[model samples]
Target: MTGQLDVIREANLGIIALNRPEAINALNLEMIDGITRALEQWADDEEIRLVLFEGRGPRGFCSGGDVRAVRQAVLDGNAEEADTFFAAEYRMNGIIARYPKPLVALTHGIVMGGGIGIAGHCAFRFTTSEARFAMPEAAIGFTCDVGVNFILSKAPVHRALTFAMTGVPVGAADALALGLTDCAIDPARRDAVRAGIAAAAGAARIDAALGALMQAEMAPVGEAALCAAADRHAGLDWTDEAAIIGTAGLEPQLAQLALRSPTSLIAIAESHHAARRLSHIGAVLAADLRLARLLCRLPDFAEGVRAVLVDKDQKPAWRPNSLAGVDRSSIRAVVGAA
Candidate 1:
């Protein structure tokens, strides 16, 4: 239990380390502000050529946003707090996407939702063998946002759709295959790689330096396996919405979403399709804001959070309870109908 964030200015690297082991480094509004400030300052600093982010302990880099807090805000009738949080978080996502220098993200343990927003947009994304990654907003009665659709859009379309719809966890090897990560390495040599990155002063030198460090730990032992299920779905015709809806790869998550806010599932699906044709992540962010604003006005987001977090009871009696009956018109209201 170090501070929630440790902002260290090394000789060569600006380290924005997440230190909240207790909460698995789950981000809140204050931490988002700190990170945005750190990056904005480092973007202008001439001495620092690279920025690196990582988390502490074995629990992982980050679980996601502090949605429990957002749920609290909704319960208190202060909707501005949740809206403000999303605005700030999405802005931080933009900064990470357009960072001027080489941005390195070390992903260990679990990285989901906001965690992916922070690390996935970096120039160099490094994942340990133990890393688990996903965009799991569907399970929480929240639609996918934070520019994830941009990343998903650029990846293999069907595979990306499966992940967006389903909340399945992808391992380090699957991430590499999906082009989500630049390097996959054993968790043991991470500290050495960090030391080398922090010691180098030139941004141009990071490419080779990081590559060499990754090479040291690329052994076959304990490496994560490729996501065969996602691969199976990727080869299918995703244009058929029925195929996606009935995908075996998505079975586990389908059940979860059914018991959740089913309308959010529709929003997530539409957002993925909307981002598929866009070039910039800015468009994705805009769509996210639209969907988020509408979802906040709905009841499911709060009810889902209450059942999952506040009460510790896993039963969220969702308003339609099933996706079959949720109308497309309602889903469109969240994502904005084209």
Candidate 2:
């Protein structure tokens, strides 16, 4: 329907394809608007029985939102644009979460940040061996939005916090193990699976169609080592953040925390903790919107985006600079800003 997005109706199935391959299909406000409009139009239509999501790119499904653009808007003193971007993006995430019909996401390659926001909420998520998932917002000086915290809340807290705070990319096996995705299908079979779903859409035979297709194409993924290790150390006192980070086995994760923005880390950790108690996606997204508004205006967001996106220097001068420099009052202010 738009240059950056492809929306089509085929055999009663509504399909959405993210088409910005140059940027790994990173979403802009226009793409978000297009997706939301399509979902809104299809929501009550008797002809549309299912919705399928896919991305057009060899590199990945979606890298994330186009935060570089948001950063530019902020630099131009148009913070309202940044706010509008997040709000519209979050609204689209909410729509995907509450869609009336069964929704399927065929995510492959790099699916991070907002990519997870959409795919992770779908009713049926299929991934390829090439799929890599992460929430790298903390690294970008942004708190995880798009209801990812809500998804991470269901996992073991230690692992969830590590993944959320560190921005570590995980493979499809780990994604399934962490409950980020539902199944792994052969990459070559993706089109067949889509065709099968499309053919079965109108007859209300989705379950049966997927069952047969999955039986034929499902690939076996090995157990995820990260998840296994997390389970092995699940007894560790996760609440004692310092002691856990200082633990010998978690040195790599601790190192990742050291590289990210201190303010973002504090906000991300607090948000992840808060999400555990959130019973629904709507509540978590509301909390996310509140944090996003405050966090984007802070200095770290600008610096982080500059270093990681604009300059590609990978060196960000965080406002607080280090975790020790961040105070409880600062954390409370962000978490309570909403």
Candidate 3:
């Protein structure tokens, strides 16, 4: 709507491109609304055969949500506004996840946070060699949301938890092996692929053909390191503060990742564990919303944002800097029944 998004019609296809190159195509409220509106309009359009989603810039598809704005809102004591934003954003994510039309997401470059929200739910998701993906909410002292709980739970056990807690980027091959991406295409072929979809017969036919094309182009390679890491940490009681930190001691990278935001890491571990037990999608989303609201009240969220973004300090003075310092009651407050 702000000219930050380009909606082009190619035969029977609707190509929705995020046009904010300056912010690496970050999803602001307007972009989210535009995408939601486009999907709703095209969902029932008889002529539209498929929806092709991509970001305009070379850096990647989308970096994530505009968290700097959300952080500023929190700093300005506008928690209510932030809550409304998340509510709308999460609703959009749910709609995309269950969209009626064929949705093909070309996810290249830095796909994180809200970027994941947009691309992760498509019927067909493709990644290029340059693509990097993650659910890095914990790094900024936030719980995973934007329907990430659903995505993570669907992933292999410890693989999901490790990704959530560590905020590490997974490459295209790793993503495919983890079921995070369906295909790995050379970035050069992106436009041709879009054109191919536009030329296809129908939405359903386009999706089926896309799967075949991906299978022909990219072969799946299993992620051994991720699998090994998961196997190593399985069944450990993450709630035991000392044990949680101690488990990271065996792996320096994991320790450093946990040290990035001890509070958020612990909170996410708890949130995901609780989410695993829920039987309904609505329940999982409600739980995530409740936790996000509570995150605004915590000091670490603000402190983490200031250190990471505002000050560019790269060091946050997280309260109780150690996991042992986190109170059980506070953890209970975040993950408690909604």
Candidate 4:
């Protein structure tokens, strides 16, 4: 109703809540602008020492951007309007990445695409066992944006490629292992943890407060064992660090992704590969923006979105229909060294 955001001041902490829970708090342009403007204003306010970002929902923190709507904007002949959304989103994401004070993201349930870009940069990120994390854009003929490569760079490259190609969601344990989240908490104790953080003194005490509450529920055991069992079932060799997904017993996921746009998958994988050599977030985001802006005007993205979200057919007639037909140079051009 308000194109709203919930702001509360407690102690020296300023809390920002993503108020749209029904849509899994999926960010729209208005929400992005609202939150970004708020953070910029908060950055200058002396009384606010720390920020706790949250989503109001029983299911997950945020699913991602309302990009299906953005695609619709483009279809309605307003490509620049669509571009404005990404620009604002990327700006907001960058602000979060460089937030001056202690910043904590309370994440649970589904966090993917733009959700990862926002929370991934926070200094203190907490997720529960219920969290499901992924990039997941390639499935809709787009690559992950907002410098996802920066996070993926800190993760295992092969696993990142597999994630890009297959859109497979990972759990908190795996996200922790992949450098996607800082801590895992108990789902039922989320409110208590928020109360603890709110009562915490400035930046220094935030750690102690979160750590105290971080133990309200111990991390579940067997994350590694769970991954191992899945790997074994997939007939993947866990020991070979050099093994790629195509060789790592992920044949089923790969085949499933074959139903999507192959060009998008390759672009994502290539971006991850290129990002490995870059160390700075600014550089990574610049590259991501370049690639994302380019992908926006392309045909497959709209087609893929129509098939996956609008039509619910789960069948997209992707150009370069087969992986073999996907042009290597064109994919490279999308995320290429300029």
Candidate 5:
């Protein structure tokens, strides 16, 4: 094990497990750098034909980047440290997306924020029944980064916007339907599946091996009730910006969005649309970098993180407290919208 990450070279498989179970394997900068280095080294390694990512602890595969530390950096007058962290994290996402070897992520439990960054780009994305997925950056007064918007954009526009704005978590079935995960295996079958993958990696039969697993017809447990409720609750007119604004209290999802930073909501919507048109993961990540640089410096980001993570208080005093109060033009500029 290396620091918070487990870097293992077994047979033809390179496995990296996030080892911070106590904190739900929340990623820190060291972990990001370590993952990047491993992936880079393995990219050219002839022996490592495939890579597998796992997360330690029962709570989830990965909760996300240590944004609490980012908040701390800003409070300590080291905002540049926060910037550096995001830059490196995004870089790692790119590396994983472009990896020459087939990459599989065995995501269980909570996969949020930075967790999605790593898992979402893999060639083979697997989840257990207990896995929950979300890109909850808006709730923390931040916009999506690490190319999450790219993943979200791949889903239906309404679903993407709702998740981005509300921070609602979806289960494995919803994830599969949304194209977030490829297969849902029984939690009890975790080891057998890992062994199967290892064998496939050794034999250079990755596709055939995984296809068998996919054909198991195992029923995906858990459903996205909240996501469904949100869809049923409202038919948002996204074309007209005004229709999406100032209606935060109209439904359950909107109520959650009401509690988030208004600026974050605007940015999420803008970025989601921008990502839809981007030609590739690299382009989406580049957009995310620009948006992250801007969002991290905003007052709402600090306050939102403080209220939600640091203080454990749900009350975040957003700078532009209402959606209508936010400047769409400025947010569009940051997200590269027309």
Candidate 6:
């Protein structure tokens, strides 16, 4: 089954599997709707106590949103449809963040963009040795949405800004260090951990097991370095900060991720610094939406997508080509109320 939203009841626990291995369990509109329905149905069910959500396949839990569709919609000039999709997606993200139950998200592999939307807000986010987390929207010439502002705000300053703008994939150690994963399990031991959850007497045992897993996977070196980098980048202006961190190799892993666009990275870094001052989620989303619309009007977005996803040409010719060309006024124009 390419897109299976399996809802199985094991004692008081509900297991929801994202079974789209073909696409690494990418979140399409249908998948989002399925998840929303499952959550709503299970929310009222007294019989179900906890929810364990996972994606099938060894390659990933959930890679991201089905952006090909969004890209196509934009190419066809159906901007309203793309906007509607993002609106619904953001609402779903908010719901997940505020969910009442003990929602456990088992993030085993590539978790990016929309994957973050599903797993980022869970009560317990579990990961494995292979787990790679990122936010690459800026690489595609889009701002981070899907309640990412909330996650960004909670993250260590420069660390959050760097990851969002660079679209870098953090390994298990870095992920734990960044507090993205509550527990880290060895890839081979993931099954054992799941079985342990199944056999646990109550939430207490599950929590204990998770705690043990996290402690076992902790990486002091990675944590300390990341924290130091965040401190170094804090309170500096975006351009100056990016210049400093980019030169210092604050995140060497970003070079290997290869999914982010240089143009998007610049845009993302700029957005984070600007959004950091905003007081509310509505303000951030509105600002992001304006930015997204402006990006569509610009040539960078389509060109970036084409170069990366269409032509498979690793090189993208950005319009501005330089950060200096992207003025504060242009950014402000996007954030300003119409």
C-alpha TM-scores of all predictions: 0.89, 0.92, 0.91, 0.88, 0.94, 0.83
Stretches off by above 4 angstroms in model 1 are: 202-204, 219-227, 233-260, 333-337
For model 6, residues 1-338, the per-residue Cα lDDT tens digits are 12466767888788888888888887777777778877888889887767888888878998887777777888898977677677666767766777777778877889888887788788778777667887767666666766666567766767776566666677776666566667777777788767765554255566676566556653332343444555665764556535544644644533322344444555566666666777765666666677766666567777776776678786778767665566556766676522
Model 5: how far residue 7 lies from native, Å? 0.1
Please list the residue runs of candidate 4 whose C-alpha ends up more than 4 Å from where it truly belongs after superposition: 1-3, 201-204, 211-217, 224-255
Supply candidate 5's per-residue lDDT for 287: 83
Among residues 3 or more apart in sequence or in different chains, the pairs in candidate 4 whose N, CA or C atoms overlap within 3 Å are none
lDDT, candidate 4, at 169: 80
Candidate 4 global lDDT: 0.74
lDDT of 5 by residue, 1-338 (tens): 68689999998899999999998999999999999999999999999999999999889999999999998898788989988999999999999888888999988899998998999999888888778898888888898788877777777777777777778788887787667788888888888777877877877477777777666735556666655755764578643345554555456555666566778888888888988988888888888888888888889888988888889788888888776688888778867787
Candidate 5 TM-score, true structure as reference: 0.94
lDDT of 5: 0.83
Report lDDT (Cα) of residue 151, candidate 1. Answer: 80
Q: How many backbone clashes does candidate 4 have?
A: 0
Q: Which 10-residue window of candidate 5 scores lowest in summed lDDT? A: 238-247
- Model 6 steric clash pairs: 138-264
Model 4, 1-338: lDDT tens digits are 24456877776988888878888888998889888877898899989888888878778788888888988988888888877888888888889998887788888888888888888998878887778888878778888677878887776565555565667787887787778887787788777777777776454666777676666555673373323334444543322223433443455544445454666766776777778877778777777777777777777788888887799787777876655666657656756643
**lDDT value for model 3:** 0.76
- Alpha-carbon local distance difference test for all models: 0.76, 0.82, 0.76, 0.74, 0.83, 0.68
Against the hidden true structure, what lDDT does model 2 obtain? 0.82
Write the residue-wise lDDT of candidate 3 on 18-59 in tens digits: 999888998888888888888889889988878888888888
User: Can you write out model 2's per-residue Cα lDDT over 1-338, one digit (the tens) per residue?
Assistant: 77899999886889999999999999999999999999999999988888999999899999999999999899899999999999999999999999888888888899999999989999888888778899888888888789998888888887887677778788877788778998887788778777776776865577777667656767887767566656666665533446556653465434566577777777877788777877899988988887898888889899999998999999888887766676646556645432
Q: TM-score of predicted model 2?
A: 0.92
